[model samples]
Target: MSHVTARVSEGERDRAVELVQQAYADGLLAPAELERRLERALTAVSAHELEPVVADLPDQVVHIASTGGRVTRTGDWHVPRRLRIDSEYGRVRLDLSRAHVPYSRIDIELRLAYGGGTIILPAGASANADGMRTEWGKVICKAPGRQSPGRLHVQVTGELPYGRLTIRRK
Candidate 1:
């Protein structure tokens, strides 16, 4: 339980590389350090190696659960392959229109109660909320449902009792 030795996927490697490059571009890393970290990130075999490469960088958000608070993500944020959200109240807004989406397909699992959620996808990104279930709420997907070649597909699943989930394309 102390270490994770699982083999890294190309997606993971690419994400790390992007983070490193971003750090350099943001002037958080010097040229020599950027080159060093980029090389290590590209050759990383597991999450262990990736830890050091991005240890000083901004942490990515993949999971969020709140009892009662508003949740929002906009601008140039990084989108992981999968996202999990649990909220008891307040609104959850996620705008991926200008974010860094490195995956072709993204999965989102939501658990909300007595609140609403909105997700805005980038242009040409297709998404579907078919897998979701609601007891006293509604799910509206304004984007296309089917997966398209060379386009991003988002699959959303979960339960949002007494809340609404709105997914639309920008």
Candidate 2:
């Protein structure tokens, strides 16, 4: 049998409904459309029924994981509402200076074992790294600790062991 005909668990149904709700919250779905999708998602029995509910919505979370080597994202890339980067041993360079960020606030969660992370924020932006914990490293924030009103705010969180996280603005 095809995946579309496979049975869907309750968790899958809940995820579909949540995706529709988030799409509405993100202004991608109208009230009537969201209601329609939610109803369909709640009633969905198989993967086929739920597949189209949020097929066009942007992903709520983007996760990048690596075992080693360099992991970088720069230039005009779409910055998601939430980002997760996990690496065992690699340098992470996320340059948001020339990126296309639609949201006012972006949350970045990083978990590194033995690699350093460098995040270059766009101008007129600030960051808060208070929630980050370093077991044997440091977290540096060159940008203002508190984000200003009407400006972009980057909230950094997660853990870094044996490596540092440097947040700066260009």
Candidate 3:
């Protein structure tokens, strides 16, 4: 009998790397351990291979629900592995300039219905919005470049049915 293996995408690999970085940042992994995990994550070919890289780290999820009011996240806040934002007739702003982003990559899911939001990343951070969808609305992305070594990666996925989503570098 043959077992099929699921292939991992670039985004998955990037997220794995991010997890390793987060562990390192949190002092849970030594330099050698971090290096090893990073190497493994970058070379991982399947989802199963990425699991061990972050198995020892803590997992966190942030949820923001807005109703006709401004919701902002900024200043020394801890960046979670997953962030879910739901907005209706309001705005959301995420500023990562001085925030502590332990993960090298962060996944943000947004559901914008008649609302808008903005994501402000640090200088070396990169964002991928290919997985996001906008209908009857607009998404403006202004960044310096793509992800590279020693840079953070943000993967934006979700739907914007009737609002705007802006991602910029600060």
Please give, for residues 85-136, the per-residue lDDT of candidate 3 as tens digits. 8888888899988899866678899988898889999988999888888889
Scored by lDDT, the top model is 2
Q: What TM-score fits each model? A: 0.64, 0.69, 0.75
RMSD of each: 6.3, 8.4, 3.2
TM-score, candidate 2, is 0.69
| Candidate 1 local lDDT, 43-153, one digit each (tens) | 888888777888888645489988899988999998886798999988889899999987677778888888889999889889989889899999999999987888888
Candidate 2: residue pairs that collide: none
Backbone clashes in each candidate structure, one number apiece? 0, 0, 2
Note the Cα lDDT for every prediction shown: 0.85, 0.87, 0.84
Best by TM-score: 3
Segments of candidate 1 deviating more than 4 angstroms: 1-61
Candidate numbers sorted by lDDT from highest down: 2, 1, 3
Name the lDDT of candidate 1.
0.85
Kindly list the per-residue Cα lDDT of model 2 for residues 1-80, writing each as its tens digit: 65446888985785577577778887889999999999998888888878988788776679999999899999899898
